[model samples]
Target: MAAVGWRGAPGARGLGGTWHPWGASGALSVGGAWAPVGCAWRPLGGGRLAPVGGARLPLRAPERLWGRARRKNPSDPNVEGKRRATIMKRVHMARKKGERIPVMFDEKGQPEGKHGDELMSWIGVLAQEHIPIWIQDWRSRDLDGLKDIIWKETITSFTADESFWTACIKSCGEAAQNFRHDLYKTFVEGFLKEESVWTRSQKVVDIYPNIEEEDWVKFVQYRTSSQFQQLSDRGSEIRTNNEYSSRGGRDGYRKLD
Candidate 1:
């Protein structure tokens, strides 16, 4: 059988040749032929050691090492397509049945008044929860994107039809507007009247514990600006001079019904 050998001199730096049972003084016999030990040249024989290149075969490909090369995330186009298709199908079926698709109805398919108000409150709550972190201006994000995210979050516990989903998105817009107004009136206009910047900044962080300090600072700056003040004054004048508006309180226009 072909054997392995090392050709380095006695006590040399490389593998010892005479270390083998058949080796003698700086040489080794593998099937009666001396072979070098620490070189790229490999012995072409059975059961004899051979030098290998530095390259190694990986057990898995790069993509397969982790997972699929293309994976679906929350905002994936395919996922969006599927959601659109489902909503369209639901709308079509409801139309075919000649039914008025209920918005925020209970599981028993009854129109409960409080259900609508609860959903509006939820929309406002979620808008308040996400907007301070994700959006500086409501216009900065596409309405559809916000709708999708909020709809997904809301549906985790609540069940509603596509009509309610559309209403929820619309309410989110109003919620954003209301949120800005509240922040302005409650904090920016009243409490933020402090002359000290440090005091104002501290108060903003205290009011909105979860919001980033930088974001709240920017909001405070914008609301206190002359341009925003002019806009606010104009809006307040318009609301005050108008007499056609109904005082519906928390029920809004539903009081008319």
Candidate 2:
């Protein structure tokens, strides 16, 4: 014993050689250099500390925060997302309602009239009837006879009015010198070329039928007599009640009733 103080127990002894069973180690040794015992002296290991017990810390990147948010609730109303959903709903509704979206046509095939409804209606009616046969019977001619019939009809119809005849001649001016040439270039010319005995011929007959043969002969004789002097003499009287109702006033240019 260096300096045995006392022995409190059989084997426990103090630094002074005294027995003290309750004393720790060697009386917390002072002097030269004291060394810590047990875990108190353990290194912190590069300043890294283990997490205290409880819930584990999340290991996620900054971008992943949004992904987690979406997954958790998923009903967040993003502006862009809501706009796209609304557009899709409208498209679906239109489709379900059988709405026809208007399409613009190329210049060459553009339709005439208000939304082409009038033309379409006419076409539907023509499709449902035997317009060609009706036209042939009305005209009293085959396909080959339409040219003469049309010319004669136009001439006879306008021959009575000196004003109309003078107007045509004045409007046509130098072109009237060659009547055939001027007539050939009229809008009716294009129609005659495009329309056949089967299509527009029937439509024409349905709209404008020839007068009775007796009436026609009388009209022709009246037109041809003395350079159509009969028309000059009674041109005003020759116009029918229907014609008076039609072309008698300022609204003469309107469609026939």
Candidate 3:
């Protein structure tokens, strides 16, 4: 508790007025004039203020702010029910006669926008559809019969495709530098001709003898790769180095009798 003048109280300065009590001054601004605002006054000028109106102002207890706050109002369930009924009536009236409400399905055959209970299986719908197609493919059907070479054409048959690169871009998000480096390595490892590596290495050393060790390695790799080599010469176009020795005792077109 502290001594403070209660404004507008008896024997004290009312609104828009100052008080000089106990040689101390107390004032508040009201309509461009100084007034006392129930605040305590202290002495000034390096001297104790002598009592003017006699004793100090009475000690007033602070107001209880918590008790003055508004309490939350209780909800009216009937009003809430009326609001819900009105909205439902409007929604039903807006719908056509034969039109059914559209339902949404997730992986678990439950509605969309629903939480927790709407679970999904490990296998996706696309996976379920494609798995049977793969199981019944020509290759799988001919598994027990005479089999053709799966890779009749080499990896060089593939061209740079926008769709493939887009898929790679989707799979590899932000760390594009490392992804590109790995993609380059995959291209080289998958399509490069290992048979020509020795020949290409010899050619690289001959072409640039003063190259650094790392540069020499890169040069050999590029030379043996389909990116730098003529794909036709190194791929299906190149004939074997063997020659045909003819003359099988008879003429041409030998028949099985």
Q: What is candidate 3's TM-score against the reference?
A: 0.13
Q: Candidate 1's error at 142, in angstroms?
A: 3.4
Off by over 4 Å in 1: 1-111, 133-143, 191-207, 240-256
The digit string of per-residue lDDT tens for model 2 on 137-167 reads 2223353343333333223322222323322
Residue-by-residue lDDT tens digits, candidate 1, 1-257? 33333233455212223121222234333334444434332222332333344222221111122223333332222343353345445545655776434454655432356545444545555665666632445555465576678887556434576656655665666666665665566555656647654234555565455667677667778777798779779878898898755322122333344
Poorest stretch of ten by lDDT in candidate 2: 35-44
lDDT comparing candidate 1 with the true structure: 0.48
* Superposition-based RMSD of candidate 1 using all C-alpha atoms, in angstroms: 25.1
| All candidates in order of lDDT, best leading | 1, 3, 2
Off by over 4 Å in 3: 1-83, 94-97, 114-257
* Tens-digit per-residue lDDT, 1-257, candidate 3: 12322223343322223333221245433223343444433322332221234333321111111122321111222332343345344334434343323324444332333211111110111111112211222224543221212111101122212333322222112122222233234333454556543232443344324434564356445545566447436533443443533211111111111
- For candidate 1, what is the TM-score? 0.46
Q: What is the lDDT of candidate 2?
A: 0.28
* Model 1, position 28: C-alpha lDDT score: 30
TM-score of 2: 0.14
